[model samples]
Target: MLSDMRALTHRVRLDRRMTWTALLVLAVATLVAIPFDWFGMWVNCLPDGGCQFARNGMLWYWPAASFLAYAAIAVLYVRAARARGLGTRVLPYAITGAVTSLAFPAAWVALDAYFSDHPYPEGPLPYWWFVLDRLVMPWGMIGISLLVLAWLERNPALLAFAAGYLALVLLVLPMGDGFGSPHFGIRLGMALPQLIVGVVLLLGAFGFRRAARRPR
Candidate 1:
């Protein structure tokens, strides 16, 4: 009985560590990627420098950033589940998120192609698709990240990350409308929620780290 209890304790500790480490890595990767996203935003400011052009640097940068961020979140979910002996119960959600990650960039390309060529005499696919590609898809991934992690563990930091991210999606994102506005301030405002999420997540990650190190 004692041996079984010890093994269970060990698994719990492993789960805690793996989850915290994953959160830390995700936060750091996002912080690193922010500059690239910012550069993309800056490029959007140039005259006729919209991301619709294949030549636009944001086409390269933003997608790369998205890949890194989502990849980390996926790994976190898988590893955390394995640590807790959950056997990938949440893996499907992670996989779905990974697949949907491509939707945004694909949507961007389609929009650009249709607009540039004017192939359809119709009014250029539904504008709501732009909303989906810009706001729904990207923010949905953030929701997935929170779900995967929070399902396993709930900490102050995790809650903060979720709250801040949802605030952005619900409040800030609509105001900026995926940075579609011509106004530069509105575009930059798009970054505010992203930055808030990263900062809060990082704080939570370190908070977990400190708690783990505390002498039991």
Candidate 2:
């Protein structure tokens, strides 16, 4: 019996180690991708600097990163869920996160292509569709990120911080009188809030990890 118990303990430790290693790799990948312009390939600016390029850089980046990050979290959540004997509950979230991650980018690229060639406000597309295509999609991506954090059972403080940051982003999205108005101020506002949120999330993840490792 003692030998069996020892073996189980060893297995548990190994599992924990593997989980931590995978989480670390996912975290690093997310950190790297978050800042880069992953959707630049989809955009092409014309000489006139008109809607030729569809300069929705923030519109593209946030959703792309959110999807990727959430997919990672979903994986972690699945492992945790399985360990806790909640496989039925966790599998759906994991699958949804992965699907949404890929779908978000595809949708953004599709929108960019459609708008770039057709021109903005062509009269065929309704204004509400435009709002959905621009604002709703990005905010949905942020919502996915929050959902992933909730799945991971992250620290409450971290969750609150993310919530506040997302609220700020949503507020700012409509405030600039559409895109590129007061370009510098809009850029500053967007970048600064994201930076703050990213830092806070990182710190929170670290804190959660440390607390998890501590003996109860």
Candidate 3:
């Protein structure tokens, strides 16, 4: 007996069948967001003529990218599903993403508050502690969102992407983002990791589409 898609599951992974074109657009959106670290409003202009290390860049970048990407994907996914006479739900993921985006900021605030309540007595705070906030940092909402989406979809590519991104982030954290340096090489070097990830995403879109087509 032939059963409709609705019989398989009440709610579908609408993005599971995302098109290459759609993926490319999503990739580009993510790629576009990589630069927010460079010119975000969440900057600390230091007296040294260089930007201070403030991890708030992710707050500007990820939310903006997510909004744009999710908005596009929502419309496109629903339109495609309806065209095929299949019902779908976007609200679940929307709610999930919204919640996920706050994970980093919330944790940061909690930690910041805790530290404020109990300041370091003798020595300075660990550098690593300060290096975590933006996507380039030790922790960021974009990373959190990526992890959440990866879990939701169980998408290996997204997982791999997150791992790769983290590797770059960890590598860059110690090197600093040209905070007090007046060298272009230092700043560009810091941004290079995200650029590579963006390129990987852009190129990986086609590969992901092809891989999805293989019989399981």
Cα lDDT tens digits, model 3, 13-123, are 533455444456556865675566656534455576765444366456665566666667667757877887775555555565566555655666787788788965578
Full-model lDDT, candidate 3:
0.57
What tens digits encode model 2's per-residue C-alpha lDDT throughout 1-216?
999998876555433332332234334543454345333323444457532233355445555565565566556656765786543233444555556555656787887799679967745766556445533443444445455544443335445645664555444444331345344344443344445444544565575567567764
Between which residue pairs do clashes occur in model 1?
A: none
Full candidate order by TM-score, most accurate first = 3, 1, 2
Better structure of 1 and 2 per lDDT:
1
CA shift at 51, candidate 1, in angstroms?
A: 13
Residue 132 shift from truth in candidate 1, angstroms: 5.0
Task: List lDDT for all candidates, in order.
Answer: 0.57, 0.49, 0.57
Candidate 2 colliding pairs:
none
Q: Write the per-residue lDDT of candidate 1 for residues 8-49, one digit (tens) a residue.
A: 765664455444565676577556655555555532345675
Top candidate by TM-score: 3
RMSD for each of the candidates: 6.4, 8.1, 5.6
Clashes of each: 0, 0, 0
Candidate 2 vs candidate 3, TM-score winner = 3
